[model samples]
Target: MPDITLLIVDDHPVVRDGLRGMFTSAPGFEVLAEAADGREAVALATGLRPDVILMDLRMPGGNGVEAITEIIARGLPSKILVLTTYDTDSDTIPAIEAGATGYLLKDAPRDELFTAVRAAAEGRTVLSPAIASRLVDRVRAPQGSTLSAREREVLRLVAKGTGNREIAAELFISQATVKTHLTHIYEKLGVNDRAAAVAAAYDRGILG
Candidate 1:
């Protein structure tokens, strides 16, 4: 098989250099280019059309999630693989939802990273062990038990004594949506009202 070509995207020059060196030294992989941010990643991916993109989630000019969304939107063939230090729901979920083919942490072993990149190039879903476990736990959680990122946001607002109207305004969502989120929260927490939900959230350590 031909070597898998890659575009390494990260804001830090050191990280990019390290990734480029790692891939170039490995067999069956080629580093086509390096980008400093999401916008640059998008531009390079569009032009080079590499087999895979190693993306870092946080950057100044643009973010990895935004770049993944745009690349998918523009019908680019490059598969995105998130390589970041964040494994939290907020970071992992959005990157996956935004069309990343895989999610791996920066601390992943060199072999694991290589395997993930190869799998991504093949259009296979790849996730680091930590991310995979979190996803599985969410799926196995009882009905309405696992709060989505948005639901967590709504719950946090509720805990702060923010009314539905205020939450809607703050989150840039409709009041109806806020209400819907509350309903889900109630069901998940096995509470009938907002107050109980807030207490349950606190008990479950969903809110800090």
Candidate 2:
């Protein structure tokens, strides 16, 4: 496999410089580009086609969400991992909805950040442990049957953002059943994936 190329997006020079320095000593990771704002990030990402992006949630000139959306709409092959200081549910959900494959805190230890970058390169979703509980709490909340009892159960696991295989074992259902349920839930909620479904569930008052 090719070395993982990263595009760092943040408005702060210190943050960008620190990230660049970290990656400088980290193997298998390269800083392909750097941008001070979202628009610059998007433009550089488009032209450079880096393998991964370390995006900040809050930035001027379109923000990380806007960059993610633009990159996805353009069908760029790079994956996005949010690297921000914000740990609130608001920042978390929107980042996912905007097509981020991973959410990470900026203050994470160097080892964790390295691991997360490797995981993101391999197309795995990574979430900081601190915000993982919020997903679990949302799953535990009582809600109406926007989905069937079984479907609701599936969606609850989904709201917690568990992978299909994890959901299958947790629910004692086959992977096929998990996919079928996911398809139905997406159709019902007008979403396309765990991220969009989570967003829809929140927006439609299906979850807390």
* TM-score attained by model 1: 0.72
Over the stretch 26-47, how does candidate 1's per-residue lDDT look in tens digits?
9999999999999999999999
What's the lDDT for all of these models? 0.91, 0.85
- Measured against the true structure, the TM-scores of the candidates, in listed sequence, are 0.72, 0.68
Q: Give, for candidate 2, the lowest lDDT window spanning 10 residues.
A: 137-146
Q: Stretches of candidate 1 above 4 Å error? A: 142-208
Query: How would you encode candidate 2's per-residue C-alpha lDDT over 1-208 as one tens digit per residue?
Result: 6679999999999999999999978778889989988899889998999989999989877798888989898999898999999876557777888799899999899999999989998899999998777656555744333467787788788888789999999999899999998876775665677788888777777776
What residue pairs clash in candidate 2, if any at all? none
Candidate 1 lDDT for residue 107: 94
lDDT of 2: 0.85
